[model samples]
Target: MRRALAIFFVFISFQVSGQGVLDWWDQLHNYPDAAGPDRSRYINLSPGYLGPNAMIMPSLPNMTIDNEFWVQALGQTHAGNGDKTQNFFLKGNFPLARDRVMLYITSVPYETWEVTPETRDERRMMGLGGKGGNTGDVAYGVIFKVFREKHWLPFNFGFRLHTKTTTGGNLTNARSTDNSLYQWEGNFSKTMIEKEEEKLLLKASLGFVTWQTNKNRLPGGSNHNQNDAPYYGFGVEYLNRSWLLSSDVVGYTGYLGNRDYPHFFRTQVQYRFNRLALRTEYNYGLQSWDWNTFSLGVRYYILELLD
Candidate 1:
């Protein structure tokens, strides 16, 4: 799997050449405290396969729909046990009475392969078994630009509230969608460097997530009692006309006394074109749940529904 991923990365790197069309990082306000003068043109970054973007798992304050609708498709391969997941996301944003207040909705449909030892052995023997598909939980949220950058402060502050529904398939054990979960997050970002065709930004966010476990049953009749945990993340983004690179570290302590805090690092590279983008990402789990993931995604701005 690692060799296949490495080869895939190399192939994509060579297939796309020249400078990127759009500053993929520029669209994210979470990197800098100040939205700057051109904030209106920036769109929110795609949440990737992890759903929300916060530390171990929360959305960042840089969420913006910018009066546009988006559709994205992602193919992800988990390095462990040779599992694979594919996802399709549809989202859009609408402005409220004020520009700082926005409403948005996101939906995901996914398919996954459950690669267990037994399943692998069965595949080797009988050539069949482990695969399932389902529509994942949906999320509806609101974003508030609590405070835009001002002379008194160098950073921008934003808040987000999201409610995720329990409506998804659980045939494979890889789904994170709960019966229902509510999340609240606060984020800040600031631009650290700016040059003619290059820019750097820093972003941080903290959040809490709580959920009901009625639908998430455990094996052996043991109740799946997951404690709510606080999550936080920090990231840096560098953007140039042809290439964009981003890296972030997020961690959270589990509620269960026996579960230690886990940290994860994710890195992404994107080649942007006018109205179109292609990206590849890798995420490494540092502690607690240990796993490596590789993902490739394609995004199209499509068309401007509104100015």
Candidate 2:
């Protein structure tokens, strides 16, 4: 009789525990007086819809190309708003026509992330929580530059066409948007001062970007599927034979406003020696984003050209 009573008690305990778990899940996900969970009410289809890389606006590139073949690897950390992310970035530049044209690839190959309880509840409500590690998108582009001395224009003119692929995974964990994006940018730069070992430059950029978003019902009851933005940036850079420093303000404005707009102040410093460089970067998010980020990396030049 004692053995039978023990078995009954174990069964009852399991039943209670299971029900408790179910109730908790329902509290996180269930919607009252609705056909089912209304996901549209929970996710806004903005930058916050996925990971940091989901809808990032491209930063302005310097008019000076690397003039050789080189590759870079970096580790980055982003922390804010009760969430944290760690990721690795890999990039390579290939010269297509010496100093005037190049092709490059930049990739966020892997990341691990964690969100706060409040963030988790929203993700759970949309059935996109319970994720940890995943890969991010890959961007490849072509850059073309026309030197000031060689052209009739007073400033060096450059152009870039970048496209990001939907190679990322783990949408359930909100690790990536799993969507493609495209950008077209025009850049202008002029040398304000020059010496054998030191130089100063002023640069500006304007671009447009478009990407797909989760189909969401707009306030006007219209369903939207894509987002488009116009991006702009301006910066100054100072460089010598051994060191480079730059700072820029970059951002984009989308049609939806608010969370759809993101701006940042970015700064970078680099130290260079024979065939190698050490680099550090910081970005302070402004306007619609609260996350700030830092990164450290090294670049190795596989081939170089000298004048």
Candidate 3:
């Protein structure tokens, strides 16, 4: 079975050898002036081609209003592709209106990357040439409760509006998109099993996410400069004493066919003691993505900050 699977993958890879995203790559070469502002016009916008923070599908927000701050050390491995990336993610949440509203901000802050010759050559060919370390975009948003759990509905309801800035650097190197992204989603959660020591809850989010794009870069050119798509996420969580476990699948799809659909599965484990928590997370990319990511972090509850 292993041999057959290997052969099958080899055959599939052969079919896409130099197609470079199935003809999209060749099309980029047609415009020799693909540089500066024009760079975003042609390069593949898939998660694999851009920075770790460029195209992210964050999980649904938990409606609890808790003052918290966290930082994570992240590493990404591209396996056979021979690319290594290291970065830090920072996030904080503060209560704005007791249990009704919360404000949050998150950013990749900084990253270092090293790619093999083959990967570098491919990037050079597509106009994203340079490498090394760079900063990532900053995102801020607000989350508010729409309905309290068990108030009128069996589930807790909330809404979130998020916006990403073009604060990231190394655009020519494709480390960032240099474009803005906005997302708004409705969130729902319901507890399924509850005990004195443990409980399970289901969570989901539904909404639209849109980002700036070059219309001419699209196949046959699009009528608009922004690409919009329906984004979604669903997951389950289990909490027992000071431990929390969760798994989720999240993604979004754009109109372009050249690796525009991106999604991934993520699992996280956390242990909390008093006002401090330790966490580790893993993400497996799916659909045109080939990177495996791991992260270790610590979270501190600053409930006294707003208390």
Candidate 4:
């Protein structure tokens, strides 16, 4: 009876935060604005900044850590709006599961390229001391939400501890923003699905992320430091099914170590003929002093990039 109750609570927690509540914090580093679907077979494709909304599905054969399941290879590329430099990523995962216990191993070899005014104005910005960079990491973690289908709002949160355990320019342990720290985030979704689709859908989430407090800042920037901060946001996605368009903004205003205020935004859209999900967003900088960024991403279900 006690075991059944524990399993039951696990289901309820999954429905609430979308995963293990504490695990969601990791998504903030990937893409902060894209609120993802709380379901199986989901993956967010945004490059460097993965928002809490772009989390992966927990129960796939390819996502387990042990030999319980197999792993698949996937690749992606992205171009930034400012710099002509491009970002690239390649990854695979192995799934592990047994009855109510589940775990996953994800390996991502990724690189980020950057160029800013500082690079352009080497003589003026720093008297010939400007520099650009490339950084990547291999992240592995365990994910186990629920063993069954959900009826109420479902939570799909998780944790994937990334060790700069590979080769990269910023692989030094002393680098504040490049090293490592524990990241966490959680999201809950309630569906008002009609037999033929619906009108109202709501998603609420809470997350706490502690970033390296680096004194060095981004180009034309600030918000550099080792901050063990936390933040939260809520969103509402209304689906008409016919058009299949969704518009939602998820943000947090400095909660217990919250770095910035009103952090991320995701203007959402879904396309038919191919079941494509899309997002265009604006990232805000709080008091920390970082350059604001504009981002856009498309969802390709055939490729399983559920962004």
- Report, for every candidate in turn, its global Cα lDDT versus the true structure: 0.55, 0.75, 0.71, 0.36
- In angstroms, give how far residue 248 of model 3 lies from its true place: 0.6
Point out where model 2 deviates above 4 Å: 1-44, 123-131, 146-150, 218-222, 305-307
Predicted candidate 3 versus true structure: per-residue lDDT over 1-307, tens digit per residue: 9999999999989887744543554454554444334544654444556656677666567665554444334443333234667788877767777678888888888888776656654543243433588888888889889888889988989999999888998765656778888898998889889999998989898888887664554433344577777888999999999999999888877775555567888999999998788888888888855567888888777654345
Per-prediction TM-score to the true structure, in the order listed: 0.64, 0.83, 0.79, 0.44
Minimal lDDT window, size 10, model 1? 40-49
lDDT of 4 by residue, 33-107 (tens): 322232110121111222111121111121111233333333333323223332333333334444323444443
Off by over 4 Å in 1: 1-69, 81-99, 102-104, 118-131, 171-178, 214-226, 258-262, 303-307
lDDT of 2 by residue, 1-307 (tens): 9999999999999999866654655565554332245434334446654567666655577777768889999899987645688899898988887668888998998988888767666444233343377788888989899765347887888898989888887664556666788888898888898999999998899999777665545321214678889988999999998999999998878786526677889998999898899999898988776679899999998987555
How should the candidates be ordered by lDDT, best one leading? Answer: 2, 3, 1, 4
Q: Compute the lDDT of residue 6 as modeled in candidate 2.
A: 100
Each model's backbone clash number: 11, 0, 0, 41
What lDDT does model 3 reach?
0.71
lDDT of 4: 0.36
Write the number of the candidate with greater TM-score, choosing between 2 and 4: 2
C-alpha-based local distance difference test score of model 2: 0.75
Per-residue alpha-carbon lDDT of candidate 1 for residues 95-175, written as tens digits (9 for 90 to 100): 663536777776665645455545333212111354555567667888787665653567777887878776664412324
- Positional deviation of 261 in candidate 3, in angstroms? 1.2
